[model samples]
Target: MTPSEYGFLKQFLKSRSGLVLSDEKQYLVESRLVPVTRRTGHKNLSALIADLGPRGSEDLKNTVVEAMTTNESFFFRDKTPFDHFRNTMLPNLLEGRRSQKRIRIWCAAASTGQEPYSLGMCLQEDRHKTAGFRFEILGTDISTEVLEKARTGVYSQFEVQRGLPIQMLLKYFTQQGELWQVSPELRAMVQWRKLNLLENFSHLGTYDIIYCRNVLIYFDQDTKRDVLQRLAKQIPEDGYLVLGAAETVVGLSDAFEPVPQHRGLYRPRKQGAAASPRLGSAFPTLKAMNS
Candidate 1:
C-alpha cells in the first residue's frame, strides 16, 4: 500500500473505531487487511481504502473497521483480573447488593466471550454463597464476527488450553469433535451485543462492575480519556471499573481511583470527595483452584 493510502486508513480507523495506528504500524495494517482484499475482491489494500469514504459501500466500511479491531481473548486472561473478580469484586457486590438481590456486569470489550464466561464460571462455583441472587452479564464488542463466535460458545482445543483449567473445562464444556462447547446454561448467562465504545452507550444502563481491559492501549491519549470518562458515567460511584494491567486512570482522568494493592481494579470516585477506602488487596488469587 502507498503511504497516502496507509494515512487514509489510519484516519479512517481512528474516526470509526478510536484505533490509532502509528507510522511504524504501516506493515501491520497491510498484513491485517490482506484478507479483506481477498474476501471482498478488492484486488489490493489501496483499492479497499479507496472504497471507504462517504461515497463508499457502508458494508465495506464496517468490514474494514471490524478487520482492524483486535479481538484477542482467552479464558481468565491475565489471571489477576479474574482473581480480583472472584476474590474481591464478587464478594463486595454480594454484600452491597444484598437488598437489591441483583447485580449487573458489563464486559465492555468482550471478545469471543471468554471474560464474561470466566465470570460466569466464577459465579457458578460460588452458587452456595449466591443461592438467591440474580446476575446479569452484558458482553459487547465492535466485531459481530467475534460476538457470533461467543454466542456459539465453542472453542478449539488450543483455545481452551490457554489459561483454562482442566477441571473447569471438564465441568463447563463438552467435547464436540475437535472443539469444546460451553454448556448452554453458562452461555445463556451472558448476553452479546455489537457496540462501538466511541459511540453513545448510555442506553445499555449502569453496572456494578465494568471490565474494559486491553482495548485502551490502542487509543491515543485524547481518545483514551474520552472513552474512560464515558465509561465512568456507566458506573455508579460505588461500582468498579477493571482495566488492563498496562492501562491506568492516574494520568488520564480522576473519575476513578485504584483499589489498594489490586493492580488493575479501580472504583468510581465519589463526586466532590475522595474515593472510599476498601478492604486490603491481600486476598489470595485462585491459582490453586485453576491449577
Candidate 2:
C-alpha cells in the first residue's frame, strides 16, 4: 500500500474503532487487511482502500473494522482481575447491594466470552452465599464474529488450557467432540451484544462493576480520556472499574481514582467530594476480603 493509503487507513480505523496505528504499523495493517482485500475481490490492498474513499458502503467499512479488531482472549486472561472479582468485588457487591440483591457487570470489549464466563463461574462457586441475589453480566464487543463464538460458549482444548483450572473446567464445561462447551446454566448467565466503545452506550444503563481490561491500550491519548470519562458516567460512586494492568487513569481522567493498594482497580470519584469516599464500609482490603 502507498503511504497515503496507509495514512488514510490509520485515520479510518481510529475514527471508526478508536484503534490507533502508528507509522511503523504499516506492515501490520497490510497483514490484517490483505485477506479483506481478497475476500472483497479486490486485486490489491490499494484497490480495496480506493473503494473506501468517497463512497465507501457502511457494510464495507464495518467489515474492515471487524477484520482489524483483535479478539485475543482466554479464560481468565490475567489472573489478578479474577482474583479480585472472586474475593473483593463479589463480597463487597454482595454486601453493599443486599437490599436490591442485584448486581450488573459490563464487560466492555469482552471478546469471545472468556472474561464474562470466568465471572459467571465465580458467581456459581459462590452460589451458596448469593442465594437471593441476581447477577447480570453483559459481554460486548465491536466484532459480531467474536460475539457469535462467545454465545456458543464452546472452546477448543487449546483455548481452555490457556488459563482455566482443571477442576473448574471439569465442573463447568462438558467435552463436545474435541472442544469443550460451557454448561447451559453458565452460558445463560451472560448476555451478549455488539458494542463499539467509540459510540454512545448510555442506553445500556449503569453497572456495579465494569471490566474494560486490555482494550484501552489500543486507543490514542484523547480517545483514552474520552472513553474513560464516558465509562465513569456509567458507574455509580460505589461502583468499581477494572482496567488492564498496562492501562491507568492517572494522567488521563480524574473521574476515577485507583483503589488503595489495588493495581488495576478503581472507583468513581464523587463530584464535589473533597476526599475520596471511604470504601471500608463496602470494599474491604483484599487480604481482609479473602480472609
Candidate 3:
C-alpha cells in the first residue's frame, strides 16, 4: 500500500473505532485487509481503500472495520480476573445490592463470547449464593460477525480447550458432531449486541460491573481518556471497572482509581480526592491482556 492509502485507512479506522495504527502496523493492515480486497474484487489494499471513498456503503465500511478489529479471546482468557470476581467483587456487590437483589454486568469488546460466558459459568457455580438475585450479562462488540458466533455459542475443539476446565466443559457443553455447543442455560444467561465504545452507552443502562479487558490498548491517549470518562458516567460510584492488566487509567483519566490489591481492577474515584499519578503502582507485573 502507498503511504497515502495507508494514511487514509489509518485515519478512517481511528475515526470509526478509535484504533491507533502506527507506522509499524502497515504490514498488519495489509495482511488483515487482503481477504477484504479479494472479497470486494479489488486488486489490492490501495484499490479497496479507494473504492471505499467518502460516503462509502455502510456495509463496506463495517466490513473494513471488522476485518481490522482484533477479536482474540478464549474461555477465562485471564484467570486472575475471573478468580477475583468470584472471590471478592461478587460477594461485595451482592452484599451492597441486598435490597435490590439484582446485578448487571457489561462485557465490552466481548469477542466471540468467551469472557462473558466465563463469568456466566462462575455465576452458575455460585447460584446458591445468589439464590434470590437476578443477574443480567450484556456482551457487546464492534463486529457483527463475532457477535453472531457468540450468539450461536458454538466452538471448535481447540477453542473449547483454551482455558476451559474439563469438568466445566463436560457440564456446560454438548458435542454437536465435531464442535461443542454451550449449554442452553449458559447461552440464555447472556445477551449480545453491536456497540462501538466511541459511541454513546447510555442506552445500555447502568451496570454493577464492567469487564472491558484487553480493549483500551488499541486507542490513543486522548481516546483512552474520552472512553474512560464515558465509562465512568455509566458506572455508579460503588460499581467496578475491570481493564486488561496492561491497561491503566494513570495518565488517561481521573474518573477511576485503582482497586487495592487487584491488578486490573478499578472503581470510580471519590468526589473530593485528586487523581493519583501512582495508578501504575497497582499492577507491577503488567503484560498484554491477550498474552
Candidate 4:
C-alpha cells in the first residue's frame, strides 16, 4: 500500500472507530482486508479503496471496521473475578439495592458476547434468590458482524476451549459437530448491540456494573479520558467499572476508584478521588485479554 493510501486508511479508522493502525499494521491491512476486497467484488485493495472514497458508503465503512476488530472470548474467562462477583459483589449489591430490586450490567466492548453470557450463567445459579429483582445484562460492540455472532451464541471448538470449563461447557453448550451453542436461556438473559465507545456514551442506560475490560488500550489518551468521563455518567453511584489487569483509571480520569475487594476492579467514586479505580492487576484479565 502507498503511504498516502495507508494514511487514508489509518485516518479513516481513527475517525470512524478510534482504532489506530500503526505503520507496522500495513501488512495486517493487506491480510485481513483482502477477503473484504474479494467479497466486495473488487480485485484488489487499491480498487476497493478507490471505490470507497467519500461515496456515502456507510455499509462499506462498517465492513472495513468489522473485518479489522478482534473477537476473542470464553466462558468463566478468568475464575477469580467471577468468583468475587458471585461471592461478594453480587451479594453485596443484592443487599444494598434491595429497595430497587434491580441489577443492571453492561459488558462494554463485549465482542461476540461471552463476558455478559458468563455473568448470566452465574446469575442463573442465584436466579431464585433475586426472583423479584430485575437482572439485565447488556453487551455492546462496534463490530456488527461480531455482535450478530454473539447474538447467535454459538462457538467453535477452539473458541469454546479458550478458558471454558468442561463442566459448564457440558451444562450450557449444546454440541453440533464442531460448534458449541450456548443454552437458549443463558443467551436470552443478555442483550447485544453495536456500539462505538469513542463517541458520545449516552443511549446506553445507567448500569450497576459496566465491564469495559481490554478494549480501551487501542485508543489514544484523549479518547481514553473522554470515554472514561462519559462512562462515569452511566454508572450509578455505587456501581462498579471493571477493566483489564493492565488498565486503570488513575491519571486517565478522575471518575472512579479501584475496589480493593477484587484486584483490577473499580467502582464509581467522587471526582478528584485519587487512584479510586484499586487494581490487583492479576489475570485471567477482564474477559478476553489484550495480551
User: Highest TM-score: which candidate?
Assistant: 1
- Stretches of candidate 3 exceeding 4 Å from the true structure: 273-291
lDDT of 3 by residue, 199-290 (tens): 99888889989999988999998899999999998898778899998999998888899887888988889888743322222221212222
- The TM-score values for the models, in the order shown, are 0.96, 0.93, 0.93, 0.89
- RMSD of candidate 2 to the truth, in angstroms, is 2.9
Q: Which candidate is the best by lDDT?
A: 1
Clashing pairs in 2: none
lDDT of 4 by residue, 1-291 (tens): 789988998988888888877899999888999999889988888887776678748898899888888776776666666765666567767877899999999999899888888888777766776678889899999998888899999899998888776777888889999999999988888988778998776877799888888888888888889899999999887777888777889999868777765776777776554434323222233333222
Give the candidate order by descending TM-score: 1, 2, 3, 4
Clashing pairs in 1: none
What is each predicted model's overall lDDT from 0 to 1? 0.90, 0.88, 0.88, 0.80
Residue 64 lDDT in model 4? 88
When summed lDDT is taken over every stretch of 10 residues in candidate 4, the lowest stretch is 282-291
